[model samples]
Target: MSEFDVVGIGLNATDTLIIVPHFPSYAGKGPFTHEILSPGGQVASAMVTCAKLGLRTKYIGTVGDDERGRIQIESLQGSGINLDHVQQRKGCQNQSAYIIIDQSTGERTVFWQRPDCLRLDPSEIDESMIKSSRLLHIDGHDTPAMEKAARIAREHGIPVTVDVDTIYKGFERVLPYVDYLIASSEFPIQWTHQSDPLKALELIQEEYGIHCAAMTLGAHGTLARVAGKFHYSPAFVVNCVDTTGAGDVFHGGFCYGVLAGWEIQQVLDFSNAMAALNCTAIGARGGIADKEKALALMARADRRVMDEIQRRL
Candidate 1:
């Protein structure tokens, strides 16, 4: 068995969550109720989910020497994830997000910033980190660094899973190395210029020759093309309080399913269950459920909305 089940390389940020009664119109003022600092990011939050699910996880990324950086480090350390490869740059501001959450709807508006000082160069990724893990996960934030990691993982015969939301420059260089391309709904449409999501997925899968091409549809659940067949899994119903880390958690659950050798339908269903449960809390990672909790939700969850999506497929 591999020493680590999964290794993630990408971004991490400290978010300041401000709560207001309701989202006010532009130029309108409202009284804010509370504020809290939380640790979250695309790959970091996913790694946290993996750790919580009892996987041995490693995180490779960059942070600054600021207070937010310290907080982010502490959170990762507390989660028991290996962070030996996480670099801390001096005199730089750590990536930070000001997330304004509406108390009424539990939706958020974010303003985030990442300093150039924290960029991860390809030279910094060593072979040892890539070869030590059974699986590799990444986001498309730093294209060069991600490409380097993907190449190393491919060389070692390790599977690579990517969570891409936007079209990054030079992203094509990284796609060929990825075995699983799970992205947001907008990404496939934007990347292929195909209006139909299923067609977009097919085009991407055929072009990259990846094993699977999938996309997450916020409330509708998930859609994917696997083994030349289309599979759709609907999102579970839960009392949603905040949806900050739902997608990230979904990716983590999907990784778990892949590693466990579950069927494609099971994988999508399990991932949807995990993501839905995560929405019933405040922070991005606040609602990550344990195995029993997730299973319970899966067994007795409302998935009518998802059933409709499957009917369309």
Candidate 2:
């Protein structure tokens, strides 16, 4: 039996959020109102959400031996995620992002950098890490390492969920091993060269033979293909803050839904609710709603935007 509910293998970062009154025009100057430091990353924040939702979570990745790395490690440790395999690379700068948030619209622009000095090689992944978890979560950053982790999970009959945004150089190699692929809305269209999102999803799922393929639409909610049908769930209305990490939290909520055996519609709604709630605050993992809050949004939230999605189906 697997010892953990989910094990995440991917990126983690410390974000420095600078709040400005409004997004300045190109080559224009603006006054910044606030500055805050937060711990977040694509896979790490998702794992934090999973742990908050009562899952036994594990994080496997690398961090630099720096203050930023220490902050991220401390946050993960406090979240109760197992970090036995988290490597602290000496003389390396940990992954970091400088996010500029416009207080006026609650939108953000990000600049991030990760040094190759902290890359995780495929050979570093061991059978024990894969076998110890019932489900595996990954991102496309370290392509080779993520591929190896997915391969190990597949061999152990464990489900693998991926959260991808950008098109990686060799991402095609990772698709065959992914069971649930929840990606950015643009990924499918770009990957399959299909103008229609529904067709893009179908083509990708058919080609890869994945169990389900889906994409997260920022304010529009999520769209998915399962059991030869398309499913759509609209984003819940909420007070906007910052959109960073919304997708990552959505993936974490979806992982919880899958573990709970939720149906497709409910899963999408739940994930959407979680993502919407996260936008009510700054930083990626901030404002992670509890089960009650998420359920409340799912049950009583408006679905006007979702109508378009339903029509597509």
Candidate 3:
């Protein structure tokens, strides 16, 4: 048996969230309502979600010795995730984001920076750590490090899952080892340049032979290709407070469903519910609902369906 249910190797960030009455237009100014500092990163927050769902989760990455890094470490420690391999770099600033949130729509605009000093080196990836988990979750940052981890996971027969939003150089090297890929909506078009999302997913899957290739369509829910068939799950309707970290939580839910042995449709539906619940609060992790709450929302909430997306299927 594996020592952990999921092991995440990737980014972790501390964000300063500034809430404004509305998004400022060109040359426009506005009064801000609130300011907050929160801990969130792709794989970090996803590992938090997995821990919240009662899974044994571990996180491997680098952090700075700065205050923001301390906050991130505290957040992960409080979440009950293992951090045995988290490296701390002296004199390096932690990855951070300044998120300008529009109160009217819960939409956000972000400016983030991650110093190269915090980059995770491929040598930092422990093969034994990769072998300890039943599943490996990674993000696109530090492509070479992720590629090494993914390759290790593949060699050990541990399933590899990825949450990628940006197109990184050398990302193709990591794809072949990925078993499940759930990317940001734009990544498909950006990677394959197919223009059409459906075709892009098909192309990626065909090339990499990934077991499942999928994309998260924000409010439109998720679209996935499994075994040559496409499955679409509509986003759940909720009074959204903040959209931060919804994708990470969705990926966590998807990992849970896959490990739980649910059908593809059920996995997408459950993931959508988890994401919707996360939107009902502030910050990346503020709205992460427990499994019971997610299931309740799944049972009762109305979904926002996109007819155009359905038509493509």
Candidate 4:
């Protein structure tokens, strides 16, 4: 048996969430309602979700020696995930984001920074680490590191899943090894330069021969192309308190479903439900519901689908 159910190699961040009554117009001022410090990151939070779902998970990444880094480390330490491979760089600050949340809509605008000092080197990834997991989860940053990890997973016949929001310079090398490509809605268009998401997904899956290519459509839900057919899963309705880590949580849920051997439609619906439930709390991880809660939401929650996307389907 694999030592771990899931192994994540990618980013981790600390965020300062600033909540306001409403997002002010450009250059306008308003009274802030709350300020919160939260621990979150792409692969980091996803691993946390997997752990919460009863998976034996491991996280491999670099962290800074700063206060924010300490907070991030502490958060992960408490999440029941293995951190034996985490690196701590001297004098480097952890990646951080200042998010402005509009209380009126539970929407957020984020300004984030990751210094060069925190970049993970390809050499830092040990072959044995990737070989010991049933599944591998990664993000887009540090292209060389992720590419190396993906290649190692591929060589071992382990399934690889990626959570990418932005385009990376050499991401082409990584996609060929990816079994699942779950990206932000903008990434497909940005990478393929196809204005239509459906066309963009097709172009990506066809070129890379990925097993499944999917995009998360923030409030509208998720869309994917698998085995040359398109599947759309509408977003679950919930009282959203903050949209901070919904996408990360979605990826976590997705990984779980894939490992569970569920159908594609079930995977998307469970992931959407997980993402919607995460939005009901203040921080990225505040509302990470248990498997039972997610199932309950999946069974009864109302769904919101985009008419434009529906028409295309």
Candidate 5:
């Protein structure tokens, strides 16, 4: 038996969320209603969600030795995640984002920075650390390191899931090792240069030999192509206070679904519910729900499928 259910190797960041009444016109000025410091990142936040779902989880990443870094460490530690592999770099600033959330629509615009000094080196990865887990979750950052980790998981016969929001240099090397890929809405189009998401998914899975190629449609839900079939899960309507961590939580929920052996449709529905619930609070993890809560939302909430989803259908 594996010591950990999900081992995440990737990035973590300390986010500064600025809540605004509405998104301002590009050149227009607006008053922000609130500011908050929150702990979040692609793989790190997903690991936290996995931990919350009672999975034995571990995180491997790099953070700067700064206040933001401290916050991230404390958050991960509190989530019952094993951070024994996390490295704190000396004299480097932690990854950060200034996210402007439009309260009116629960959408956000992000401005972020990640310094090179905190980049995880491929040499720092220990094969044993990844082999100890039953499943591997990773992000596209620190490309070479993740490529190594994914390959290690492949050799061990553990399934690898990747959450990538954008294109990364040398990402192609990592994709073939990925069994499941859940990316941002823009990623498929950007990576494949195909206008249609369905075609993009088909091309990715075909070329990479991945089992599943999926993308998250913010507010609309998720779309995926698995085993020559497409599944669409619509989002649940909620009183959203912040959209900052919705995608991170969604990936976490998806990891849970994968480990639990859920069907593709159920996986998307559960993940969408998890994401919608998280948006009901102030921070990235503010509304992370347990299985019971997520199920309840799935059973009772009204689903909102925007025109983007309708057009696809």
Candidate 6:
């Protein structure tokens, strides 16, 4: 049996969350309530969410040997995730982000930086580390390393799930190994130059022959194409406090559904619920509701669909 249910190789970030009354206009200033330094990242937060949902998770990545790095390590340790393979680069500052969240609308503006010195080299990827997990999750940062990991996982017949928000240079090399790809709403359209999102998704899947191609529409939920079928799941209504880690949580939930062998529609719905619940709190991982809570919210929460997206589908 594998040592972990899910193994992730990707990015981790330490965030300083700034709470402001509202977002300011360009060259405009606004009084901020306060800021709290927190730990959050693409694949890192998803692994944390998976661990919280009772999945045996493992995270492999690199962080700077700084105070922020220490904070990230402690948080992962507390989250019950295995981090034996995480690299701590000397004389480097961890990846960090400053998120300015508007309290009135729960919207956020993020400014982030990741030093090149903290980059994970492809040579550091070990076959043993990846082979010990049932599922593999990765982000597009450290593109070469991610490609290496995903390829190794694919070679082993392991399903690779990618959480990408933007186009990365040479990302084409990574997509062939990816079985499940859930990306930001802008990624597909941007990747294919096919203004129509659905068509873009189709193009990507056709180009790579991936099993599933999907994108997350923040407040509009998620849409996926699997087995040549399009599945749309609407965003659930909630008292959204921060939309910071909503997408990461959705990835986590979708991972859980995959591990549980859920139907496509069920996976979409469960992921939507998880994302909605995460938005109810301040920090990135603040509002990750338990299974019972998510199910209850799924049962009672109202969903809003994007009319344009619906019409497109």
Q: Pick the candidate with the highest lDDT.
A: 4
TM-score to native of every candidate shown: 0.97, 0.98, 0.99, 0.99, 0.97, 0.98
Given candidate 1, what's the lDDT at residue 259? 88
Write the residue-wise lDDT of candidate 2 on 210-243 in tens digits.
9999998888888899999888887898888999
Task: Give the Cα-based TM-score of candidate 6 against the true structure.
Answer: 0.98
Candidate 6 local lDDT, 76-128, one digit each (tens): 99999999999899999999999999999998989999999989899999899
Q: Residues 1-313, candidate 3, lDDT per residue (tens digit)?
A: 8999999999999999999989989998989999999999888999999999999999999998999999999999999999999999999999999998888999888899999999998988878988989899999999999999999999999999999998999999999999999999999899999998999999999999999999999999999999999999999999988998899999999989988989999999999999999999999999988899999998999989989998878
- In model 6, the runs with Cα more than 4 Å from the true position are none
- Write the residue-wise lDDT of candidate 1 on 102-138 in tens digits: 8787778889999999999999998998998999999
TM-score for candidate 2, residues paired by index: 0.98
| Global local distance difference test of model 3 | 0.94
Error of 2 at 66 (Å): 0.9
Candidate 3: residue 157 Cα off by (Å): 0.9
Residue 29 CA displacement from its true place in model 2, Å: 1.4
In TM-score terms, candidate 1 sits at 0.97
How many clashes (backbone atoms < 3 Å, residues ≥3 apart in a chain or on different chains) does model 1 have?
1
List clashing residue pairs in candidate 3: none
RMSD of each: 1.2, 1.1, 0.7, 0.7, 1.3, 0.8
| Reference-based lDDT, residue 204, model 3 | 94
Looking at model 5, which ten-residue stretch has the lowest summed lDDT? 304-313
Candidate 5, TM-score vs. the true structure? 0.97
lDDT of 5 by residue, 1-313 (tens): 8999999998899999999999989899999999999999888889999999999999999999999999999999999999898999999999998989999988888899999998888899878998899899999998999999999999999999999988999999999899999999899999999998889989989999999899998888888999998888989999988888899999999999999999999999999999999999988888999999999999999998767656766
